[model samples]
Target: MSSRSYDIAVIGAGVIGAAIAAQLSRYAVRVVWFEAAHDVAEGASKANSAIACTGFDMAPGSLESDLILQTNPQWENICRALDVPLRRIGALSLAFDDGDSDSLRNLLNQAREAGIEAELIAGDALRREARTAAPSAIEALHVPREGIIDPIRLTVGLAKLAVLNGVELRCSTPVTGFRHHPSGAISHVVTPTGATAVGAVVNAAGVNADLITDAAVAEPFTMWPRKGQFLLLDRAVGHLVPKIMCTAPTPHTRGIYAVPTTNRTVLVGPTAVDGDDRGDKTTDGDTLDAVWARAERLLPEGVERRHVTKTFSGLRPASDRTYRIEVSAKVPNLVHAAGIRSTGVSAAPGVASYVADLIGAEVMELPVKSSVRESIPVIPRLAEIDTDVAATAFTARPGAAPDEHPIVVCACEHVTAAEIAAECRGPVPATSLDGVRKRTRATAGRCQGAYCSVGVSFILSAATGDQPGEVRHGEPGSHWETPVR
Candidate 1:
């Protein structure tokens, strides 16, 4: 076996792993990233509520609180450098009753303890700011730093930047096992292709992190899957809520939240359900109906189920306690980043920096590269293009190869065939329909790929040299065999 060695190897290409890999690439180190799935961010990263959380509601003195507080400011810098869409649109945790209002005051104190600056807005001021709030809500806590982000774009951007900096990313490569070298503190990771040796390994595998570490070293903790399902409203209702609207915090979950996405679509929901099932379960009609009922109570005239485009679910890797980020005491070179639940997306950049610091302290002579490329290539949006720019682009690349510029395939989201093609041909290219959907947003709109699935499948077939019948949805081993009528 021709063995490959690296300074660091990160298992799982979720948001946290991608962020860590991207940050590690800024230093002069050989980095290898492994994903069990066909693409990056296909797991918990793709399915969350997509909120850039401020540390306002995290448990005080917890790892999540620390990371959330540190990452909030770091996001602005990272988003700007990477061209990831992040809006500091703020949030409102509305209280509908007097008891809830009292709870809000308590939360304010907790927020202060967590180092989040927030204020309680009441009466007309609260009404004026968030007009869609239920009339019953007499007060609200306005967390000014809370924001919304495109999680997929952020993760993809980080992975792409890491790739440009010479980090080798291997998708469809699941690490089945690992062996510790007897002489040195190195590990030989076994993948589907072959084994690769590395000086150190970071287990950031979201829900499956514990399983990855179990075979080699004793896991420090365990992770439970907390499923959160979300409902996506059409763009027509996007203007009704200006900021991320939410309910008073609860002990089990964050409560239902209404958020306006960067793409001008409003989203609501994420009813938390605890389970061991890792697959994205079908959105139950009953669950969605309950969510909408709550949403109507929150926004009154703002929510309409008729405008509902899609519903999806994501699993959060909740632990018995708080998030765990530390090197294993049993294994010297192994680091475990597990139990990263809801706040992982917002806390990812800070987590990356923190992990880098930990890894750096152990290695004797690791040097930061003076000339590592910090900037990410910009992805031009078709919706953002003006008439003149569109004309110029069309002229530059004619319609005969119409997929070169922008051929609007998904009319609901304005996703172009070119964008799908580009994502399919990327460095760590998309291998399934859901992968394309996450990368280019081809199937995530009002129609949910009902009208455009065939076209997207054809595009995938053409791009990957696969037959039309061979193109599957996001999950591996599943194929789109049914011919489109």
Candidate 2:
């Protein structure tokens, strides 16, 4: 078996792991990233609320709150540097009755305590300003800094940035075991591919992080999958929900929310159901129906079931504790960045920086690079081509074949042939149809690949040199059977 060595190993290629690896790449350290999935963000990062939270209502002094607050102000620059799409369109928390209004007031107080800007607006004023809001909402809590982002794009961008900066990313490589030194430091990480000798390790494996931790030492906490089912409406309904509309927070969850995606589509639902099965991402009709009912109470009249394009579920790493960002006392070289729940997308930047500090001080010395690439070139998509400059700004990568005729592949989202091929041939190339979809939005539109899957399959077949039937839709062993026609 082949073997390799690295100074540091970051497990899990979800948002948190990607962020941590990206941040670490700026230093003079040899880093290796491992993901069991076929591509990055294949786990919880694949599906989410897509909201860039402001931490305005987070509990005061909590690690989640502090990290969110610390990172919230950096998103504008962060998104710009990473070339991820972000919309600072703000969010509203609607209150249906007196109890909810009081909750809004309490949230406002919490925001004030956290030094976040927030205001409670009367329902009449909210309805006047945000025409899409329901009239039954007695009051609304407005947090102007709350926004929407492309969560998949964000995770991919981070992973790509790390790859560009000399971090070796090993996709489909899950760390199965760890070999420790006599001093109790992790000396090697064992994966199916091979074993890699490492100086330190970071466990950011989402719901499976506890398992990694327990492998080295008895973990103080355990993790379960908190399943959240969501519904994606077509871009036709995007105009109906201009901003994020949220219900009052219950003790267990933030409740169902309706948020606009950067792709100009509206996302609703996310029924937070806790369970022990981390692999059970299946969606039920009854659960989704109840979530849709809650969404209907917040959105405008134009939203209908006909506009629904996709239904998906994600498993967040739910634990008994809050955010766990610490170096393990049992294994001095092991760092824990797990149990980060729903707000992981928003908390990534802060968590990354915090974990980097721990790794530097406790694990090893991370010398800052004299020079680092702060930003990557932005590749404009067909959907984002509005200005004259953007239309004329298309440039093929160094080794990519020039697209003499840019044929439209996904008509629902305006994804072009060149875009699909580019993602498939990217530095972090798309090995599966879902990978291409996350990068280029090729088959994630209104038709949900009904009209575009065949085209996309052909593109993947050509890019990877796979046969028509060998082109996989998503992970390994998910190949599509070509028609007999």
Candidate 3:
């Protein structure tokens, strides 16, 4: 096997790793990013709650809290730079009884103590703000800072920036083990494709982070998949729930809630179940039914079954104890950013900054680039364009080329041929059907690819120079073929 060398090796291409790579891009360093999956954000980063939290309910002195608190206020600027969509529609945690009301009060105090702007509302005011809330909800803790984001785009955006800034991205390359130097620090990252010598290693490998950590040193903790299932409602129901409607947290789990996505769909659920399988994304009717029932308690005006467009699941990297964000005790060159659970979306920026600093202070000292490309041009998403204005129709944003092709490929989401082609031919281009979907939302609309898959397949085929049959829906072997019913 051929060997290579780099200043740093990031072992996972999830949000955290991608963000770390992006942060590192600001400096002049040789960095290599690795992903076991076929693409970035294929793991938990793709299928998350998508809530950009304000750390309102987090423990005041914890690292998670501190990072989230620091990162929360910077989302507007970060999302803008990345061209990711963000909506600050706010969140409401409802109360059904006096006990629940008291919990809200305590949470309010916690929020204030953490410097998060929050308020407690009752009766008429709560009802006025949350029109779809259950009639039984007598009180609520309103956190206006809570919002939703396009998680997939956020991950891809970071990755794109990293690639543009010269970080080498290796998807479908899984790190099998590690090699050590004379001092017992890691010297190389072993992978199936090849082994690359490195100065430092970052184990940001999500649910499989524990396994990655164990490969480098003795396991400090174990990781299990904390499964969360969600039901996506039709975009037509988006107006009915404009705000994030949440329920009081239970000792074991944060109960079901309803959130509005940037795609204009209503998301309801996330039934938390701990398991051993890292690859289990299976969702069941019974668990989803229970989830819907719980969500109904928060949103009284029920979403019709017809509007339930899709049900999916994601696994959070749950650990036996607190989050591990320090250098490995034995493997001095390896850093652990594992055991991050549901709040990764909210805490990614902070984690990225902290890890970069740790690398600079502990692993290596690198000089900043004289010129840093801190932002990239936003891709012209046809859906976000003001097509209604005939005078300004088809005019691309600044730094983007004009859209000459007016042909709409995905009618459900207004995804145009140009948009699909652009994503398929970017710096970190889409190589599969799902990749295009994540970047352009082509197959994520009302029909959920039923109406647009063929069109997307053909466009993706044309863009990547792959045959129609060669264009897989996801990773290798996922061919563009219909199932035998």
Q: Which stretches of candidate 2 lie over 4 Å from their true place?
A: 1-3, 218-220, 387-404
Q: Give Cα-based local distance difference scores for all models.
A: 0.82, 0.87, 0.86
lDDT of 1 by residue, 1-485 (tens): 32668888899899999999998998888998988887899888988888898888877777778888888888888888877888988898999888778878988998888778799998888888787656677889988888899999899889988998999998888888887877435468888788887888898999988887786665556777888778888888788887888888766557888888988888888888888777656688898888888877666474678888788888888777657788777777887777788888989998988888888886434588988888776656576568788666634363356455577888877777877878888766777898888877887787888889888898888887889888988667788865657
* Lowest summed lDDT window (length 10), candidate 2: 396-405
Q: Clash totals for all models, in order?
A: 0, 0, 0
lDDT of 3 by residue, 1-485 (tens): 54668999898988988898899888888899999989999999988888999988787999999999989889999999999999998999888988788778888989999999999988788888888656678889999989899999999999999999999999999999988888999888888976788998888998888888778874567899989999999988888886888887766667788898998998898988999988999999999989887887765565676789899999988888656888888888888888888999899999999998988888889789998788876766778877576226654446553333646789999988778888888888899999999999899888889988887888788877888777988989988864466
Ranking by lDDT: 2, 3, 1
The candidate maximizing lDDT is: 2
Off by over 4 Å in 3: 1-3, 388-404, 482-485
Worst 10-residue stretch by lDDT in candidate 3? 395-404
Q: How far is candidate 1 from the true structure (C-alpha RMSD, Å)?
A: 2.1
RMSD of every prediction: 2.1, 2.1, 2.6
Clashing pairs in 3: none
